[model samples]
Target: MKLIVQIPCLNEARDIAGVIQAVPRQIEGVDRVEVLVVDDGSSDGTAAVAAEAGADHVVINKKTLGLARTFQKGIATALSLGADIIVNTDGDGQYAGHSIADLVAPIVRGEADIVVGDRKPGDNTDFSASKRTLQRVGSTVVKTLASIDVPDAVSGFRAYSREAAMRTTVFTRFSYTTETLIAAGNSGMVVASVPVDTNAVTRPSRLFNSVRSFVLRQMVTIVRSYIMYRPLRAFMVLGFGMILIGLFPMVRFVYFYFTDGGAGHVQSLVIGGALLVCGYITCLVALLSDVVATNRRLEEEIITILRRMEHDEAARD
Candidate 1:
């Protein structure tokens, strides 16, 4: 099987060469291995450095498109280049390149559609205590939403089979790590995490400048992706909660009215009625949202089929 290791770079000229060179040129059960560098509109000569480092392919974005888009572009390019498997790593070399073999083993053996590299809990000495705590919480939240248990939900080191890669699409611009896992789980792709070693910290993350910002952004991403994938369920829970809350006040109002012959509880009646109306509206919105979510899923399936057919035709050509 042919495997392509893709690195998304943005102003990473200093570390790109080392990341490229560290990629294993040969692995058991893989006939060929190649490197693809995606330059996210880097002004620091990252593309030139990648080429100089002997990257098999380099695709440059005209403007900075963020990590999600850059990763999507890299996947598309890898598919076009006849890559049977795609492995994504960072351009900063934070992940040990030598561990890529372990990452891809499950995919090569048909045991998993996607393999995530687990950096091991408490292993990142560079991360502050607060950062590590946040990481744990974020990973737990992602796992609950995605229905997949992954120790390192934010790890950039991952491997995807061609089928998984073809069926996946990244919608959020903030990060691909979390969204991809949720998408894979929603699309019924088998995901497995294996322990892998990480290289020492190379540079600070470009995704977020501070821990506060990172937490805020990641929380937004998780909420947005959850809504996108499970809108019906989300809306249903919200609607039900609102209804229950409204019912409590309404019940109290009714009890007061019955016991006192409708005396001195006019305000309670008004408040309860208002809440009931709001709850009913929310439930109506949930129904409409469910229909839209179904349509969206159908559209996605059609697009996936068309894309697979196109890829097959291209391969034949």
Candidate 2:
């Protein structure tokens, strides 16, 4: 078995070397281990530093494509390199390298397709009170959306088996941590989480400018992922909720009209009628979206088959 640890870097020149070197060269069940550094248009010579630090492969992007795109690029490169297992960690040296073996153990033992390293951000002293609270709330939202129990849903340290890597596809431009979990859960891929150690914060997050911004982006990601996987259910609930709320005003208008001999209560009738129209339109949209989602699933199946064929040809070559 060969394990490829991929680090996605963006101007992390100072810490990339240590992160690469920190990875263990020998794993109990893996025959070989290698490091792959993907430079996200870093102007700080991150790619060069990774090469000097003994990274087996370095893939450089021409321009910055955000974390989500960079992560997908790294995964593709790792798969092309014939990696039997892929472990993703940040280039900032935040995740403990020694914990990598523990992180990949579930995949190595065939117990899970993907294993996430739970940093228990709520208890981490390095984070502020607000950040800790955000982590807890965000994780709860992700668990519900993904239908998976991951304590640290935004953790960057994670391991994926070869099959898992081949089947995974990410579309969000923000971050992969949440979207991937939701996708895996929806796809019925086995996911497990293990406690892992974290180093002190080396730098502030570049993903968002403020707590509000982070929360907004994460919520967008969560909602989009949930809608993608469960559009019918999501829209059904929304349509039904709107319809239920519309009924209250309509019923009130009817009661007031009957009691007051039907004078000057037309406003409520108009408002409720508009709401009902909107709710009905939303339900129609849900049906159309369900049809689109079915087409997407069929396309995905075709893509998966093509991917397997490509991988088989690569192996033969």
Off by over 4 Å in 1: 261-263
**Which pairs of residues collide in model 2?**
none
After superposition on all CA atoms, what RMSD does each candidate show versus the true structure? 1.4, 1.2
Candidate 2, after superposition: displacement of residue 309 in Å? 2.0
Query: What Cα-based lDDT does every candidate model obtain?
Result: 0.89, 0.91
lDDT of 2 by residue, 122-234 (tens): 88999999999988888888788878898988999999998899888889899999999998998899999999999999789888899999889889998998999889889
lDDT of 1: 0.89
The TM-score leader among the candidates is: 2
lDDT measured at residue 240 in model 2 versus the true structure, 0 to 100: 82
Candidate 2 regions with alpha-carbon error over 4 angstroms: none
> What's model 2's lDDT at 19?
96
